[model samples]
Target: MLREETAKLLMMIQGAYPNYKPDNKTVTINTWNLALSDISFDLAEKAFLAYLRADTKGFAPAPGQLIALVHELNTPQQLNELEAWSLVEKAIRNSIYNSQEEFSKLPPLVQKAVGSPNVLRLWAADGSYSEQVASSNFMRSYRNEAKKQEEYEKLPADMQQMIDQTNRNSYSAQIREKNRDAIQIMTTTENAEIEVKDEPTGISQQSDERLKKLIEDFRKI
Candidate 1:
């Protein structure tokens, strides 16, 4: 059922953009459909819809893009374990420290959770960590700890010390919420500029007044 749907989707994409024919000599349609066989029908359809709606001029969506879209949209539980393992693999590659140095840098809690040096080296160096070891719990803990450390480093020195002394988890959440509010307000103000007055002198004065008001409002924030 999904195979046939995939075939139809391929045809739809080609039909929508006549100039964008995939290199069938390198990859046949059957092979592409086979690659996407594991994806559910609903996910495939949604991905196709999203592809069609994209504001691209002339390009067919690749098979890999469709697979990625399914992963991004549905994110099934079993696939999450695989993605978590991939994150561990990425961290290993991205680490500046050698195996021993990186192993030592793990938080005590993470070290305890990850087990011995042999296992740590396998995870960080060889990408041999099992899905069981890289469970959702470990993924969440590692990501949260990394995010906290990153945010802490970005703070002013005094603010960092104050947060450390207070040891308040809510402080991070408060900062994130404030950032979100500011972004929303800015977006609203930008979208509110619906009218463009075009008289020469009138436009110049209006622009000056609007700029001044914007600067004043920003400073108040």
Candidate 2:
């Protein structure tokens, strides 16, 4: 899935604007990380290679080729250079480039993934760490949230069936609730069977109370 997503996105960008300087820093890795986690440099290499193939043979990209489909819609027959260039700009901004505002507006899972430094691992070594670091709190929350989501995904289909769990329906709304409850709202109809993380703890008992209070106050950060 990660490879396919990477392939489609690279294909879209390259197909649209062949002359654009490839900024692996300003492009490719981060948005790809958000849209498709588990995507490594190896997968990206494969995606770019496949993109070259698509360019050569005009072969249809695999089934879930969203950007390919979108580009096809934008320029069906031989695209005028200007139209192709325009689509390239849009695709670069929408896919290759990373915008904080755009990241903030992503679906919860995408937002969560984008919220983490680990997701932007490729760019870490590019001297942008001071300027583009993901906050520890944000990364922690993203991981916590992603884990609960993974748990929800692993539930048996028969145990928690869905008819229309679209962005407008149960799936999107539940992503906003704090982690454990969000998991329950998605899957555990019984509620009794759900697993929640242990409540936040402090160093000790009497001092622990004060520590907990201090921690909560700090979290208002």
Candidate achieving the largest lDDT: 1
TM-score leader:
1
| Deviating ranges (above 4 Å) for candidate 2 | 1-110, 115-133, 163-167, 170-221
Write candidate 1's Cα lDDT for 65-154 as tens digits.
776666556642232334544544554553422433444565543543444334444454455556565566567765565455544543
Candidate 1 minimal-lDDT segment of 10 residues: 186-195
RMSD of each: 23.7, 19.9
- For residue 53, model 2's alpha carbon misses the true position, in angstroms, by 45
Candidates' TM-scores? Answer: 0.34, 0.21
Model 2, 1-221: lDDT tens digits are 36455555566656656564456733553555454453344544455455555666544333235333333333324323333233323322433223322334445554544432223332333445442133443455555665655445433344335532453366444434333332222222212222322422221243445445555644453
Angstrom error of the Cα, residue 103, model 1: value is 18
Candidate 2 achieves a global lDDT of: 0.41
Question: For model 1, what is the error of residue 217's alpha carbon versus the real structure, in angstroms, after optimal superposition?
Answer: 68
Whole-model alpha-carbon lDDT for candidate 1: 0.56
